[model samples]
Target: MAPLSIQAPDDGTVLGQLPTDDAASIDAKVKAAARAMAGWVDAGPMRRAEVLLQIAADTKAALPELAEKLSKEQGKTRKEALMELDRYIGPFIQYAGLATAVGGRHHQLGGGVAGHVERGPVGVTAAIVPWNFPASLFGSKLAPALAAGCGFLIKPAETTPLITLRLAEIAQVHLPEGLLDVVIGGPDVGELLVEHPGVARVAFTGSTAVGRRIAARAGQGLKRVSLELGGCDPFVLLAGADTGAAARALMGTRFYNAGQVCVAPKRLIVQDAVADEMIDLLTTRINRVVPGPSLAPESTMGPLHTERGRAVLEEQIADAVDAGAELVGGGRPDGERTGRGWFVRPALLLDPPQGARVRTEETFGPVLSVVRVRDEDEAIAVANETPYGLGASVWSADRQRAWDVARRIPAGYTWINALGRVYDELPFGGVRASGMGREHGVEALESYLEDRTFIYPAASH
Candidate 1:
């Protein structure tokens, strides 16, 4: 068979291909997973942590090959690509460390109810991971589900399915084959896993449109679903804030992953007092960060994940420019950019008309849109305008005031002193169109588990 190439609408090639496993095979995998999980669930905290330790060690040993292949295949810069490895490794270690300490709590009994409730694993979980942050997102889903005594079937994104599949291969030794399995393909395979009755729970990360579809399918099966969908997060700067700090924070949020991140700061709102300085500094930063082939040492930024990603972002930028959004850095297509892989210059555009498509749309690219506001009130209103509430960043010299304003925003996670960044130990999720449910942190394990009521009323009662 020929090598798979992931092209968007233009090149017309499929990236990853998953084998068709019949119902019998699916059943076999599920059965194997259940059996393995039974033993794993009973392995006790120390033994389970030991198993995770081996996996982490194995991951480190495999890092060079794993990171390089994942980075090259998906067009992420080596640094950004390697970060996934760290993300995966850290969570496994953290979860393993906390496993012995995790459990349900006792509640005060009232009325006729005598005993508090307990939570238990719901059985096999089917996890579907997206292309962006492939390994990290996969780890985010799989680690918790597994830690909670659940088995899983992985459906990795087409652009970067290899690493996920590879993770499963290693699991075959330590994970007992179906205890953790990977079906290496995209949406077609996803439909099978989602609609399959045997798969009890589903975790997905991707666009909101697809999330809705997954929700619909999962709903039919009454399968538990956890979604981390698209986010057009806003980063606000107040009049009293340091313009320099805001610019740096925006640089980190807006350009990380070449701006393909779901919670990446898509909007930059600055109070008018320092808006001009803020925009100028932002332009300087966007211009300085170079984008190119994945392997380039000097390349801090990398190509878009796929041709389609690059094309969509380009169109959005074009629309914004035509719609009168001032382009501070991008809009010129360089030969170097067009000649090699899917690459676009980082864009810094000022806010255009109200409800402009660029302003409203999630441009998951190396682009940042700037909006000017008269005061903190307008800043909050503008920030909260988006239907997404995945996360937001607030910057001000008055830390207390920034925290107050941040609380008013609709996003689930808000950073007063930093950009829209995440640590694996914290709860992460969105409020509205950004999707429902949380991933990572202690709550992540809880999301995969179901609470049950146990009654032991007194005989007299």
Candidate 2:
């Protein structure tokens, strides 16, 4: 089938048409990646780093074009999309340099000291990337794979395959033929990518349910796997918090990527002192966020990636309202083709009932759930109630108190008085249904690697 051009979620730009690879095409690419992987993985660390550095240079040169394409196809404004691309360069270079500088650095043990701890690639890797942050996600997974001397076959989300495909072309410039190949299709293609015989490990970023299925398939093959799944991270405003600070942080967390971020703020837990004030401030801030194509310089919010995306969000909003949640601001999209594109008005849901959609489901939309609680214990209990444990935040005037609450939250990463932001030098992963395995920091290189213990007694020592 030919590549398809999909509409942006809201007033965003079209995420350009993408060529859809057929089953045979995919098979060929998978084989090619495996072949290239074997050769690439065998190269010394210096060679791999050289190639990776080249990829970084190429990525920088292509930023403008890539960003334009990202906006057109992914519904991000050109500026936002460009910035996203810019984030990949540094991480990519960092990992590249680590390719050889990493591995078993010869750790010391008790007594006479053991040999060395070594890490090597597990061979071919398949990275199943998502749509919301295509370039970043793909690069995040792929960069480390390359650094670990692993070859990869990527199956990008059907809704946003443009960047991945283009990346394949650019990557080939620095890599050997078939070092990285991107295939486009739906969930079925992903199934194949995970289950393929040549694939040694499956690195996936998507929903929890899908992550489970992928795990099952990878299990059947006995292939190593790493999954980065969904989240409904909670943002807590303590009694002593500066309401203005909490409000500003919540807005940035809840509405980033039009709330399509898997680790975005899903529930707002506030203490009495700041509850009412937080709501008022949040409402005003949400209302002012202008909606347009993701490519537009003025666009702070864009349409959901698809009509179904909007529908799911709307249903959640409606369900939350029916369940007695107060709709604070905005309403539904005017029509299917309203406001220049798939634009949805930003909305805030206040005090949603226990079973409300805004409360229970991951409404990957321009809506947020606001809830009030009496104290820190209830706040923690409410925050931990959800199945997700990806990321969370706490805002309090007392730094120690904020840190205490942040630490107690059942999440992989916690922030005090700020939304969760990632550092490439640190680990990022979630517990529970948010999926397993660390994606960044030192472990990122290890994720694509297999460990080997080398023991050399007096003879070697």
Q: Rate the local accuracy (lDDT) of all candidates.
A: 0.78, 0.80
Off by over 4 Å in 1: 1-27, 104-118, 332-338, 456-461
Candidate 1 residue-wise lDDT at 180: 89
Candidate 2 lDDT tens digits, 339-407: 656567878888897877566567787787888999999999889888888889888899998888888
Q: Number of backbone collisions per candidate, in order?
A: 0, 20
TM-score of 1: 0.91
Which lDDT tens digits does candidate 1 get at residues 94-157?
Answer: 7777666656765547765566566667878888777878788878887777677788888777
Estimate the TM-score of every prediction.
0.91, 0.92
Give residue 431's error in model 1 in angstroms: 0.3
The per-residue C-alpha lDDT of model 2 at residue 448 equals: 85
The deviation in Å at residue 420 for candidate 1 is 3.0
> Candidate 2 — what's its lDDT?
0.80
